[model samples]
Target: MTQQTSGEMRIEKDSLGEIAVPAGHLWGAQTQRSIECFPIGTARFVWRRPVIRAFGILKKSAAIANGELGQLPADKVAMIVKAAQSVIDGDVDEEFPLVVFQTGSGTQSNMNANEVIANLAIRNAGGKLGSKTPINPNDDVNRGQSSNDTFPTAMHIAIVEEISRDLFPAVTQLRDTFERKGRQFDDVVMVGRTHLQDATPVTLQQVFSGWVAQLDEALAAITATLPALYALAIGGTAVGTGINAHPRFGDVTAAKIAAETGHAFISAPNKFAALSAHDAVANTSGAIRTLAGALMKIANDVRWYACGPRAGFNEITIPENEPGSSIMPGKINPTQCEALTMVAVQVFGNDAAVAFAGSQGNFQLNVFKPVMLHNVLESTMLISDACRAFDTFCAKGIEPNRAKIETNLKNSLMLVTALNPHIGYEKSAKIALLAHKEGSSLKEAALNLGFVTEQEFDAWVIPADMTHPLPE
Candidate 1:
């Protein structure tokens, strides 16, 4: 078939039909048909680089497995491996142009990778491009795989790589920053709020400790999902029967991917379970969802604590990265917190889509894989970036307002709870009510009401000691 046309287009044909492809593109007939079909939004596998690289790694492993099984010729394997390495090295990202909303099984994107690698190999061997003679995309490039298995395999590889390389470090750094600040503010006692109402006294360090605990739980949730995510579906070609694929293809391909990524990529014990369901991806998305909620809570707390300099809590100060209002002057805002909170909302939404996609898997394969993986990667990237921003701009620069903290601690009516042991619960409640009604301090109301002497009040209601359990 004649590939090149007048200037910038080429004719390409697949089983379905023929279409005009861009003259310079590495994609072939199937990809061209997808471009003509599915005119969805412009979110072309937003994580294209990582997703493509994962495909590169998958194809390379497949070539090695096929070669070892005597299914592919040595020279063809060599050409495929070398070309796939370039994909892994991020050399041909421009070639994969399909969006995430395409075919339910991600076949279009898989074929896109196959065609590109096949073209690269042919070109390197000094053959005419677009000529699928010696290196057929389906036969040579995707030797022992189906989109059903390969797409999910790529999804797992990309998610694991991103979490290990990006999300873990950013979240760990943010947690460390919170802990460091916790130590710095350990001695500064402030009024604690419950249900957004003044409740009791607590050290600023203790408040930050809560944030640290939230992140700790989030990190643990993510780490726990790794074993499931490492289970790849590569060997379960077509419908998890290893049909048309070597018996050892799954084991060998998984080992090669593990070696390439320096991570443990394991073959699924049950191919049917791995192929028919995406419980692993769903579980990972749930963990990420929990992380998003945790970060959102932390960000909201920071913004609330730094609400106002004169009217709000004013107990803590966060780094103000931008102006709070368009018209208000000298009004710095917690921009990092705002940005992180927005990302958290987005993750929440993405998790819903991922969970729905996971549940949509029929008997053999999940058609919503592209959308599921797309949402997962988007959530990962957003959370990772938000964590870094929060650590750099907000958590690290946070400082305590000692004067405000001391003033609030001294005037809080809730501190009267300490008098319960010395006097009685009934009498302490009376004094607290009196203090609030008369707009007087707890100590003054107690003194005026003759509940306790100043000496006794001072001895019983110690703010520092009230923060935690008494001596014994």
Candidate 2:
């Protein structure tokens, strides 16, 4: 007797012959074969929620297009639409049990979605599971579609959606918070460091404004990648010829997607290039990597500025979210900055993976779609979450240490830089060195050296005037 004889599993046939699938499952033999064959559980569907939802959206749009084009029966189209809706709404997310490691073309994941939608449609039609009566997973649910086109199409969908729905908002939040803090700390001034050495007096406004500018440029870079993402390869079945697919399939599907998403999605002008190379995906990752670079600098600046309550720069103070040390009492650290910087490092690693995977694949079809999209989506989601957390817990709560700022500003020997244009560079350097050597103030050193007397020193070394240029 077969496992089906026990009533716990059901026997179904595919190209590989009979396979036992759990009777309770909405998937058929194909999905069961994938489950048994590729047991890679790391990059599972659970973590790839965006890709899975994109699959549902793709299927629903395809079914509607197929029905409208007189490709499938109306009843079957209705059944597929309803079943795919469950996938889109996440009502039947458990049915899709595949990993990104299965088939680099993502054929198995496509099959998994096909089978789940098929069985669900079949059941809804009052037919037995795996019947293939009401809907055939390949012939009906995946009509006019190929893993070659669908996987990348879904990749674009998931990426664009995630960027719009999550990444963009999170980044904007951080940028807005930094801008607000910049204005709030506009009046505060402190010693600026260059090469980790004191350079001159800088306003908190200048420091925070620099961070805001980085964020703004990053936002623009990420936004610039969207137009490429909007172009998709839906109609290019198998080898970009649209052999079995209707000629209007790609255009219609993209239109439907655009209607459903309100994004300007379009059919790729060259389906061959879309399937053969992942230039768009790689470019998008490159943009995100650039954003990671900016974020790393900003986060490092925050932590360094808020370095110590006693020994370090201590020009700013961040919110104490939790006890930073297990052994020390009342210890708080810049945990958010640490988390954000770590996220930046991870994004850097993910971008490398994406760039590498996107570069692979032969003439007709790219076999590295799954891994590339996985890394891209992972990076986007991580950046989104990290930005939100960092902004809420850290950036919004940054407060300038007025006493520390004053002390550091007063003690900075670099204020003598203002004397350069007035007394020339050599005299200013002499005063700075003498001040540092004797632990004396710039005023006292200049007076002892007789560079310009008390009145000249006071007029030339004005801290506020040093930040802005004076008429030569």
Candidate 3:
């Protein structure tokens, strides 16, 4: 086998230093040019490794399918499958360094994986690296695939693996924490606010229950979209034509992926539709955005509720990890809650980016591959981190300020909730307004209005019973 010298191919320099690409690989010129053209930063896709590894799985499965159908030589298929298996098992990653950003419809990344796996197989078989004699990138490694189908298919598979492995579990932890908190605070009564003003009296349990409900809905949305992502687009090479691939390539590849990743993956019913449409990813991003919105609402409420031990409505006390203000001597702020809120906002923004990328498909493919992966991975990581942080730093240590809560409850003339069923809405409103205007208690305002005797008022106006219907 003839070996090409490093100087025989184009070289590109970027933040990761120089990468030498051989002329035989489809990615050589484009990756070289992209490195120089998009020298924006070291901002490469975070899930690139998993996606590339998934490509190796697809390649191996494709080879197995081809050989089973008698399309490739048995010995050659075995060698390629062996190499691809090494990659599937994470035996090689250093050689597949082409950024997820590429112009040849992800052909560069596809070839990067193919070249790396092929070379690894050759080296393992006692041949030199980059030797195209026995194992070649196109003829052997990429035996039955193309970037058009493989990239999106691998992306979907990788994201499903990530969500099942990481994102969903973290969210479950947060949900369980909220549930426990709800039960713990079941009887602790506090004033509930709407529009940032006291509206009625409610137990801290109800407030925590709201958070739990949001998390529950978010988890449902995320889990429901996993099936959509599990549908693979393999065998739809270049333009979903299955050009050179066996008829059963898609089904066989999907089964291999499911076995390899321990997920219930399947081939898309319409390879053409799958290759041309990114609706699966967009749906996934929509679920993520919904979760982000929920997280934002929960985090914002937590931060505001824990706002001040002195100036703000200090209903709940958050843990103090660091000094809140450098100048303020004794102020403790909701830093963890604030971090969660910020991450939620970033995830929302990422959803917008993903939506835009998903909508910009031209004819057969969307060129916004890098951006789509970027936003999805970013949202995943941020959601994971924020959920964990909120659980550990905020929810776990959070304590309802019983004294402050009772004080606010007593002082809030909005305790008119107790009178709603007794004296009717008009009289209750009049009493609340008079109390607020005259700086008097509900008892005083009611006595002045001749609404009820002191004994009857005391018997009927129960703050605890106002939050829910009285027990039968």
Candidate 4:
């Protein structure tokens, strides 16, 4: 059932027969049908610019490949390429208004791209949008592709491009910021905690460096999956067979995409696995999940360190971006940490969705293409945005409250562990307990207990030496 609209409507036809589409829009019959059938999540498709653009890239590459193989006329190919370029440049992002929930295989969105591009090419060639005269959506634009192959192909393209072009840079920038902070805080010794209790001493540098290392490992894990994402399943038109597609269509299209995008994309050697299962997307998302876990740890630690000026740890200070409370006039909070940690949680949830959807490959086709890829892309962009925001507003502005750090370090009973080498673990434990019980300094506790003289206490309980190895 088409929604009643007050506008000039054009009649368009597909295999399902005629449907009325708005005259001002570029999409045709199939897209119009999808709009009616799945009247859901109208605002949901707006963020899918990357996926739509990936379709444009795939469509353009297909036309080029078809033209090169003498499968499509040069004039038609030219019009399709120009029209597809408009999609790739985001000029026609508004035309692709199909939500992620429309079709599990993203068939509707594939047709949506086909119709929009086909009509654009038709209009470019001085023909009616729905006539399919100078260009046909199925025959010209989607000449050698199917929703089965092209949908996953576009998923890979979007995933690879978004990770490489957006996520990596944002993560790298934040990692570099933490690394620089590590250097700046290298000399600042601080108390370390395990199980939310003081355990030993570590420089603030070590904490920041640990975050850098986690990011490095996560980045490598994500990078390892890109080669798999670069593998395109284009020639497997419907099932795993080439069928109506040209034999070299996948290879030529992958090569064209690689050349255009500056990524080393190739045709998947096993199109069956490529189209049947989205394990590449799942694997990449797993890596992103690890990064999310790291972000959770980093953000939580930052917030804990910046807990309070008087009551909590108060060892570090983050940026004060805004008023932190509704009623409190002078209170500030770790808002960036909260935002980043929330994004990390969201990525974790998205990972679960991606994993579940990726596992739903029934035989030769995974009908869960849109859900799986949608989650992966959403996680990627979320982490990218979160990392950049956290870096700019919080991590980059982080500064050790040196006086507070020294006070905390001096007050930590865990520093008694440093005296273990000289007096033994049992005696060190006694001294720590006594200091805690009596609210006395380690030196006072040791002297009162006759565990060590002032000179011995001073030598053994040096906080600087406790940060790393030292001889007794």
Candidate 5:
């Protein structure tokens, strides 16, 4: 809703020159320059709520640290902190109008936040908006910090917050659902497929167990990356030298951030590495990529398992929540699984973008902060939402097609593998081949070939036991 026509305009000036800014907008010159300079996409940083909130939190923390250090007066610090709180509460989302494709260093976004917070502080303190008198964007709001460090710090904090607050719980819920299904289907045995061909007898519970394990591993890997991410890149200022930043700034700001976020936020051990490289973020992206792979596998498994009532695997029926087809009658697609799979693909894409962005760090700063943060935050939100959706829409509603499972289990030639321990591999293979050739059950083929007695076949060919074999 930018006034493309004749709305009131205000003049804002930066180091470059004066520009016509929207009259009511809180963002000032740098943000205005970014708006006019790079009209790349309508996509703005407004969608990145976590990043913005983290920026707010970082600003508030910095103000507190600076105030305690006597760098800024207490009144201005209080005003800045309150303004930053407004940002955290999402009271001024419209104030931030910069896009993710702005300067690679995210200086524009940093200024956007500074300007918004400063104007709000001015208004709260009974001063005029756009009057940077007591609450200057640079001297007060952005004191002792630079986009080089603060942006990356915000990126890390936001991602860590999203993962801990949202994504981990969603994934854990999905994992727990899989565990529930595992126990529920413990005795329901079916033919296990490898390379899309029958391989051995496996209980449905065991398949679910494997799924739970995959999710567990993925969640564990993602969680393991948190410690690295908790190390903030703040207080490094323009470069790794700590420039105008106080020596106490890094630790105090980190402590304040940790207090606000409820996460263990630590100052980066090496400011140079934190500012100049984004390997931690890259490691996080890699973890998410691994989780995406797991989700893709699980979603595809569910989709394939619920494929058809008359054609495919058809061993489970997903809940019919909506009419799946326009013309076809009584059609219920595995839409949730399809959605989850698509999300997995999208996360994969986001991770690729994040990985590439993370590597784009040149010398004293990574210029790809905005895109990196956008992609990482997008991946976190998508995966979290997809996990929740898959759990509620698909996992919770899965119905075992016991009749089909039994039918397939009874007819499967791979059941002969269960007889290997008792009858030897060669004889088992022969029995399996005979069953396939004659279109007979392994039991029937074994009986015809006199490979074993009925009593022995019944004793040794228990599918449930095959899922968890007692040590030979």
Candidate 6:
């Protein structure tokens, strides 16, 4: 017979040939039921280790506080915390195997974590598997926490960790790359486009600067949403009233979380409101949507600018890494930009899903936790990957077509910047219209106007200097 310890469950191999459920834990029934019931999405919540660990931290903190205040051993809290840290560090991923689709309430996930931590603690105390000898799931493993509060709190912690460790840094690197390119091309003149029509002359740097500005706005929006995420629903319990938990549990658990993660997370001001709502998730989703929009703009711009070797914009040439087409040999496509745009589109879709999920909250809780977490985490990972790929494959390797830039600049009627110094806006507009209507150059138009001498026209019509304010 399998020996049992407090919080330990008997180890059983699933159909996937994976070891799970070491006996004696409260989560065994739920995990087994989840495996048997909803097997919709093959994907598991594998990357949610941070969230799981956050749950573990809260549980351990509550247990310790409860033990100190009432009836339990001091070392029980340490055992649970150490067990949770092991899982957090990815030492035992196979131990968790719940379907991504459950009640959508995240109860299964919370229970799974409680069971795993409890069992690991029991084993650490030299107890046999499936035995709840040292750590009880309710009294010790999940002392002062409830799934309602723990789920959202853990979700916020996970998202914030990912944003700080991965998403923001990736965006910063990409932004720096664009800024460097902007400086590099500061002197390169190109025809500026409006409504797909040549409207004026501008430096390539100016065009790139527009992209940088958009990225900067995206970064700011993302940063602004972090504060909302930091305010967690730790002590909310079932419906945000500390129901069966200590009054100080939320604040103290949040403090422990902050200390462990190095992020300044705090308990929500109103536990009741937090447990019943998903404002943090919605706000963060908006930030991700903003990022997606910026990325879409940047990628579309690059693809359009790199469109043609013989037909499209052809103003800029993208580096050809591999043969773009199998059938059409020698054809190179904007694959990197295409990928980025595709990811942006997916992020937008995810944002919509998150919004809908967040809005569907019923009275005491929202049952859309699984979908919300999946989409949010997906958006984070995809954005990071797309930014890195775009930076390396598209942005870093981009080269301006100098001949094309010069030709487009020369052909544009908006070279009126040179004429603006001598003539006012109306006169410059007339000269531009005449140039376009009669198919004449700006110099010819100015000559016909008798506004300036040919030498004066030639000296003033420098396309490179047309983008800035005319000399005073």
84 Cα displacement, candidate 3 (Å): 3.2
> Could you give me the TM-score of model 5 versus the true structure?
0.96
Off by over 4 Å in 2: 1-7
By the TM-score metric, which is better: model 4 or model 6? 4
lDDT, residue 120, candidate 4: 91
Cα misplacement distance, residue 33 of candidate 6 (Å)? 1.0
Sort every candidate by lDDT, greatest first.
4, 1, 2, 5, 6, 3
Sort by TM-score, best first: 4, 1, 2, 5, 3, 6
lDDT, candidate 3, 168-208, per-residue tens:
98999999998898899898988888888888888888998
In Å, residue 115's CA in model 5 sits off its true spot by 0.5
* lDDT scores in order: 0.90, 0.88, 0.78, 0.90, 0.87, 0.79
Model 2 deviation from the true structure expressed as Cα RMSD, one decimal place = 2.5
Report per-prediction Cα RMSD to one decimal.
2.3, 2.5, 4.4, 1.7, 1.6, 4.6
C-alpha lDDT of residue 439 in model 6:
94
Model 4 residue 221 CA deviation in Å: 0.8
Residue 52, candidate 3: alpha-carbon lDDT: 59
Per-residue lDDT over 329-377 for candidate 5, one digit per residue giving the tens place of the 0 to 100 score: 9888988888888988988898888888888778888888888888888
lDDT string, candidate 1, 98-128, tens digits: 8778998999999999999998998899887
- For model 2, the local distance difference test gives 0.88
Assess candidate 1 and give its TM-score to the true structure: 0.97
For model 6, state the Cα shift of residue 172 in Å: 0.6
